[model samples]
Target: MLYRVSVSFHKNYLTIKNDSIEIGIMEKPVKGKANAVIVKQIAKHLGVSKSKVRIIAGEKSQDKIIEVMS
Candidate 1:
């Protein structure tokens, strides 16, 4: 399954509305920390492994295309 997610960083809390996912993380965007958290959270939310979720595009942008392998 593939999902399109619109992400917002530095929010007060993490939320998922429709195809959008807002995450609140203290980690900076440097060194791919924030992206890591996004993948982990998405995997947990979808009941999948972290390895199963991959960001196919928009790696440095808020709008991302994710591929989820079942």
Candidate 2:
């Protein structure tokens, strides 16, 4: 499955709205911390492992496209 997520960093909470997954990360978007958090959260949300989740695009942007392998 593939998902397009709109990430909002530094938010108070995480939210899932419609087809988009919103994540809140305390860590800044430095050293791929936010990206790692995004992958982890998505994997948890979909009941999958982190290795099964990958960011195929927009690694350095707020909008990201992720691929989830089942």
Candidate 1 local lDDT, 1-70, one digit each (tens) = 6777777666635667666665666567887887898888888988999999999998898788888899
Task: Candidate 2: list runs displaced more than 4 Å.
Answer: none
> Which portions of model 1 show Cα errors greater than 4 Å?
12-24
Quote model 2's TM-score. Answer: 0.85
How high is the CA lDDT of each candidate model?
0.79, 0.83
Question: Alpha-carbon error at 16 in model 1, in Å?
Answer: 4.7
Identify the leading candidate in terms of TM-score.
2
Q: Which pairs of residues clash in candidate 1, taking residues 3 or more apart in a chain or in different chains?
A: none
lDDT of 1 at 20: 61
